[model samples]
Target: MTEGVPATAGSTRSTSEKTAIFWLLAGVLIPLMNIVGRYRVRGLENVPEAGPFVVAPNHYSNVDPIVIGIGLWKSGRMPRYFAKASLFRIPIVGAILRKAEQIPVERSGNPRDGAGPLRQAQQIAAAGHAVVIYPEGSLTRDPDGWPMRGKYGAVRTALDAGIPLIPAASWGAHLIMPQSTNRLSLFPRKSVDIVFGEPVDLSEFANRPRDSRVLAEATLKLMTAITALVEGLRNEAAPTQRWNPTEHGQTEIGRFNDKR
Candidate 1:
């Protein structure tokens, strides 16, 4: 809500487009999720009303994306995600991604596809839109659902675009579907909560080259913001040190057993 901090236009998906997607998707998902659990959203006003902004959230469960997407959709911002290129190759889903113009990220080091999504994110933001990114890249490995370490994509895109970055936190999503599994459980309806925090002040870091030093500092600050929000939601303090997958020899993108 600060001056010169947020955007001045709706997401690239015009109001009608957002509505169409919202109702179209919600009509099916709302009732399905409601049957599974209730949703409680807070601090939506903290979301930027205009321009290109980044929504950075901690990842914990598969359903959380749907929950977050609904929250953002309700706030008039359609989200573009940094989905894996493989998912974009699926049949029906791939068709949707192509039509929506979502960004595809290549996790492998093919050199040819390096940093493709990050650069695309900057261009998307520059054109006046919003993107939702999981700074952790994937679900948390913290058995207790706390946010682990963050990647640089979200913060880098914000800094590169000179746009406000909002840190979002969600709790009770892991309950919708257990960790490391996609099996849906609707027997017990749970409460899914999502909150959006104030934009991280990175004006000082703007215009700086994307060096290791700058990305590291910005990544820490961004994670700190997101962790604080999750801490508030959980009403408990997070560990002083973030859990690092590489250091622990765990996978970053999927199940720990995943060697990739």
Candidate 2:
């Protein structure tokens, strides 16, 4: 583990409170969002029942995490997500996030430094809690609509810890809240599909070298799966676009310096 990022304290609330907050939010807001557009969920059962697992998804909007959390919670799981540290610095929201044990990631471009939150995330997952990570590290801006290159920290941490890596796909969140913008407009009642992909086994790398090449391959494979899922979902929204690397300028991965 890198220096200075201490492990988070466990929540004082019982599982009931956690479950209640999750369901109440999902039940109230998810349906309201769905009423605007049909929420077509697939591969939900792909989420594990109990165990340390990584929920790696394409990041498009801030709402992506909320929607992802709701979907996971509905499926009898709740993920402690790695979020921007700045978000956790918010007054009430930050306090809540800190209490909820969410990992606060520093987004500067230093690898050794970036590992702080990731290490904490790995600890959380290793302790038998689901953890959500955005491998891409930021939202995508592909003119042709494709997933960007994913960073290596998420994959490395999951593989090193021997945790299940679950790829996730989300659509329509960008419309609700686009990248680098805070103003949330009333969405067009679009159905945002949140799908979970089958777990990718990285046990081979669990003992293998953590070389740059090895880590990059693992990260790429994971990102490819996520990009494929995202492309599929995007195609559902706009059939004309394809996620082919040649067509899309870049995928949503590796779009930021995720250092603390």
Candidate 3:
């Protein structure tokens, strides 16, 4: 873990063994997914050996975060996700997620529960944990399935926390598990690929406030880098299917655009 950040607010849980078990499961799961789908990763060397860093990846499917999280776990880092608070209500599932130390992001548009996701991420990074952020705040729905506009939370976190930002991209997950449904399919033999780019530095804003546009600009550039990575992985290939946003519980904009 990196130094200089404070401890988590109320985490009394022990993550050491859980992390170990998670890695063990991810090891088999990731490789199995790869072998079954014939996927491979390129640019795994881009992640730091140790970190107080943020991982920004393009989001296209619900499985995107799990894939990226497992990938990072296999690479020797504990991935802490900043997920919506609503997910914390599911019975046994919520308990597991809580023990995993995933940060809860209250999306009621309230700013009173301490810092927003960005601020929470900064605190986590400052404490030496690796954070994953989807700048778009949700999944993509482009006819071609490219990354869409991203929110400013990621930029704010990276700037305020003063950590390296790594751009990551994932391909074929949308097909493996469609964003519109909760079921996995076995039809397509496509391989999922995750590409991590070299860290983007923003040392110039080390001491800046969490509200600067510079943070948003930095996030935009990071998003662009992730998009480029995804584009490369796709090799200009077309999506196997065009999912309807309504089927996935998304709004006019949120349902169709690339999230995270």
For TM-score, the strongest prediction is 1
Ranking by TM-score: 1, 2, 3
Pairwise TM-score winner, candidates 1 and 3: 1
Best lDDT among the predictions, by candidate number? 1
User: lDDT (0-100) at residue 147 of candidate 1?
Assistant: 91
- For candidate 2, the clash count comes to 11
lDDT of 2 by residue, 68-121 (tens): 876786677777877778888799888867767788877665666676887798
Model 3 ranges off by over 4 Å: 1-36, 109-114, 207-212, 237-260
> Worst 10-residue stretch by lDDT in candidate 1?
1-10
lDDT of 3: 0.68
Candidate 1 regions with alpha-carbon error over 4 angstroms: 1-14, 17-22, 109-114, 256-260
Superposition TM-score, candidate 3 onto the true structure: 0.77
User: Which digits, one per residue and each the tens of the lDDT, describe model 1 over residues 1-260?
Assistant: 42344453454444554645446666787778888887788888987666678999989888788888877866877778888789998998887776666798887745356378888888777767788989888888776778988878888787766678899998987888877678887777888888988888886677678897998898899899999999998999999889887776777754544322
A best-first ranking of the candidates according to their lDDT comes to: 1, 2, 3
lDDT of each: 0.79, 0.68, 0.68
lDDT score of residue 154 within candidate 2: 74
Question: Model 1, residue 83: what's the lDDT?
Answer: 80
Please give the clash total of every predicted structure, in order.
5, 11, 16
